[model samples]
Target: TATGWAQGGIAAAIGADDAPSLHAADTEAAGAGLTDPAVALRVAAEGPRLIDWLVSLGAPFDRDADGALALGLEAAHGRRRIVRAGGDSTGGRVLETLVRAVFATPSIEVVTASVHDLLQDENGAAAGVVCERDGARFRIRARAVVLATGGVGALYASTTNPRGATGRGLALAARAGAVMRDLEFVQFHPTAIAVGADPMPLATEALRGEGARLVDETGAAVMAGIAGGDLAPRDVVARGIFQALARGRTVYLDTRGALGASMPTRFPTVAGLCATAGIDPARQAIPVRPAAHYHMGGIRVDGTCASSVPGLYANGEVASTGLHGANRLASNSLLEALAFSGFIADAFDAMPPAAVLPEIRTARASSDLPAIRAIMERHVGVVRDAAGLQIAVDGLSRLAETGCDAALTALMMAQAALGRCESRGGHWRSDHPHAAPARHTEATLRSPGAAPSEPARTDEALAR
Candidate 1:
């Protein structure tokens, strides 16, 4: 199973007073109009059903004494409908349970291997993934390939993703001539634990839902000036933290009075991590700052999770299914992944299998891992502009000129980051501060045979 360092609960319209329409509207607003209205409507409508399915599969979401699902409000939502597994430890708890269920299922096989490249047939249809594990290489051929390998958060210097989230799937898909979308829009979590750990552990946003306040070192409220304050949109909050850091002030999320004695009962993971770090949230404020958390852009896919290439499907963080748009609402990433996984699974199972054919020859290529990671961290990081993006594009292009498969992935991210023009969501361009006229720009890198005329800046075309 794939792993993520996600800390937020899955958002849904499960609250008694919440409706899918309201949730969809909130999502669209948070997505800044780049959201696909139809996708938003569909996901929101299916929210409750998906939640019910997850619960039935033994997700064990937290519930009140009356057996009603407990909900929490995250940064971007109109209602408190985020279903938690155990307070702020929702992602861990849910994934652990799902992993157990998946392991128990007889038909499913879990392989612990890292996929290096795609295995394609003579007709250019995807057949399987070439992977390596413990010094052994193997090809796991299947009728359909699902890219649930998560996001590129690790491309940044500081991120909240597992170390494996190096945009491998994004690069792999790109090299296979599959179209990628919106690779530029990255969502930085506003409040990662700032005690100076690499890939800094997170301080869940649900703390804010429990009434934690964002304060400066002087014990004064820092979010009073913003519209939503502590509950503002993620981008706004991240920028706020950035500004605070720029001024050399320590920013903190005061959870002392907010959570207090009930902290362990609500967020055991957070409590344990804090304790390990010599902190007591019930008694002191926790230092925090922004860190790369999610990628709003990824491999472009249709409504059914079909990529540009035949027989290749992508879901979860790897696929840009147009549900999250420019900025993903808090907790929606997990929901999107689950929803698309279901869609891809059902769709793949229903398709008739192609006749067995001879396997295509596979190739191994060199990778400049350090160079690609450095380039992504520098240019496509928290704050971006034209110059840095161009530098990133140039650097990746130089790497790709070496004819390595891994370099091609870096090239894809660089190209897409360069193409997106406006400062929408987490892709804040210093040159363009305001949101441009409403547009849904999907980040796409051009194939050799594709059009080369400035990448066609049209609604139908990909962003790059």
Candidate 2:
């Protein structure tokens, strides 16, 4: 995971949809089809088999009353494919199992350090990573480098991701001259716990699946005019919550009547979080707000998880395989990690070894992370406009004088969001409120400030 932890996610995996859950209209709205639907379905179909594999490795799961794996909360796409464990603590539980297995394995050697950059060979292929550990900087030389450095949620002031998710992988890849696609599409979770916490606690959408509703300070339905009410798509709900907060009306997830009795058992994690915040979900509503939760855009990769840069591979949230498009479907992240991890392993085994190169050391760039994060939250957040994006661009450019990779990654996202004038899926623009012709935005490190090279047809980028 990006946080250098055993776990790689928020850990809810989606199963196959029994029917055609995705549609053309919704896809158009989501800027979907960057990844083929058939590919997503194929990976999703392997969910049961993957679950069985994990079970054999000692991971536990929670089943429904019918003895079937309990499907998690339905998403905006109208499907209930999420399968979880330890109730709301599924990610932690899953990570624990993986950690134990890894430690038990004799071949694996764990390194505790922060990676500074990707080392490249004479032919411009990834060779290894430069890292800092125990107050000393060192380089580890290898034939290939795989970056799984997580997402950029920490770039925002209010986010559910750990602080280390500063888009380091994206920065490393970009610095290595790798192509990145769709850096603009960041997904904001609709109901993060609103306590004044740094890494805010998430109020899982499953609460709504269990019957909770969103309400305003006056106890009026927040999603009253929306079609799906509280069960609406994440972007919709997030926008609504953002507008509600803008209106000075505090929003909340009213679980008092919905999951009151079952709170402690079904959602022990959430219950404990609420208790810590001095609110009992069994009797009172849980205060909530929208938060930076996931990034849909990342380092561009092909079907086999190979990046544009030879010998470079990315997996987990760091790689953009075009699977999620402008917005990610819930619980698909873990599924992608499992599938691509296997694919990359197979690919790695088949490759002929590259000659070992000598280790090279370089100075690391220092950044004012707090200032950069503030600029992002203010300009390139849930809703954006040209002027704000320009301000972000200029601010990031100034920060980039330090050669900070984090600032560079933030600049790329702001540039992409600014160049994309139309509002589509997660890249909502207050200035450009309507969708234009659908296109995939691509960029490289060479020209960060240039407009997107002429838009390409949808067929040009979709996953096989």
Candidate 3:
């Protein structure tokens, strides 16, 4: 579960001095002008209630000395509005809480299997899914299908996401003729622990909020000439670290001066991770580098979490609701998922009965992941240029023709990155280096390996 790997807490305006509007302002500021104000406001207003809902399910969130919820701070947030659990083990604890609640419910059944494809009715609406479990293929027909399969960080060689984060849901949506929006906006965390590990360990952004610094060898500040120094928006910090590494400088997250001896209790997750890498935060600066962390782009969905496909829905990292826009605000990922879950439920309940499911055979081909990862890491990484992006699009297109879902998703991402022709938020183009007009990128697959001629653009928020 990628949620279990999240060390930062959920952002919510629960403080007495804070309001949802203030929270929305900070979100919009971090979003680089693409975040929908209404979406931000609605999600912000849902924060306190969502926290309450989690508490009712025994989430065991951390509390201050007064027994109220302990609120921490993160980058780009103006207030101490991050609600956490067990210090830095918020995601693990929350996952445990939800699992317990889910098991307690009688209507749910937990299945361990891989969904290979979606089944559609005669009218082209989603109706079911094809599943494979223990070497046996089967089908489970349903009225609707909701994809929550997470982000595409695993497409890159260096990432903090689990290996399974390969954009499975995005591929599923695209193959079903659903719109994908801003597939280029991949967020790279500036502080992935660089100790020669695959799927690198993350040093949460909250560490910087607690006064950590980004320094290179000889204690030179890596972000010295940059605005906001070590506490800038994620994209700025990532570029700083990336450019520093490109110049043969070894970057480090100097937490020795910040948390130090209190690291174990304050951030035991990162402390334990550092120990495995043979680093002692109390005595040494932690070596770090930028790595793919999250995706602000996904299947285009409306306010109700409904996709262009009539009976297909999306939530969490799988759906683009125009909240994150060009970049996602720190700690807002978990909050967005929580707020949208209710909207998805309401949409599902009001839907008409599903049409008869048509019998459709589905098959999946093994992907050459090493080849795909190498292309993405070299061409479409933290920094991008037209020549490299064109190379990526060409390479990925050939793999997509082989019926590789991972490759199709990567090709879409590369196409979107190439078409944008400007640096904005997560999609930085070294050739362009500056943003043009602000507009959302919309695309859909007409056929496998077929690229859109030009991406559609809209300056306003996606339709509600």
Residue-by-residue lDDT tens digits, candidate 1, 26-69: 88888987899889888888889989988888887889899889
Off by over 4 Å in 3: 448-464
Candidate 3 lands at a TM-score of: 0.95
lDDT of 1 at 439: 63
Please report the TM-score between candidate 1 and the true structure: 0.90
List model 3 lDDT by residue over 236-291, tens digit each.
99999999999999999988844867888989999999999889997899999999
Across residues 321-383, which tens digit of lDDT does each residue of candidate 2 receive?
766788876666777787788878888876555555545544447878999999999999999
Would you list the rank order by lDDT, best first? 3, 1, 2
Q: Assess each prediction's global lDDT (C-alpha) against the native.
A: 0.76, 0.76, 0.87
- Candidate 1: clashing pairs of residues: 182-297, 182-443, 442-463, 444-464
lDDT score, candidate 3? 0.87
Q: Residue pairs in steric clash, candidate 3?
A: none
Q: TM-score for all predictions? A: 0.90, 0.90, 0.95
Best model number under lDDT:
3
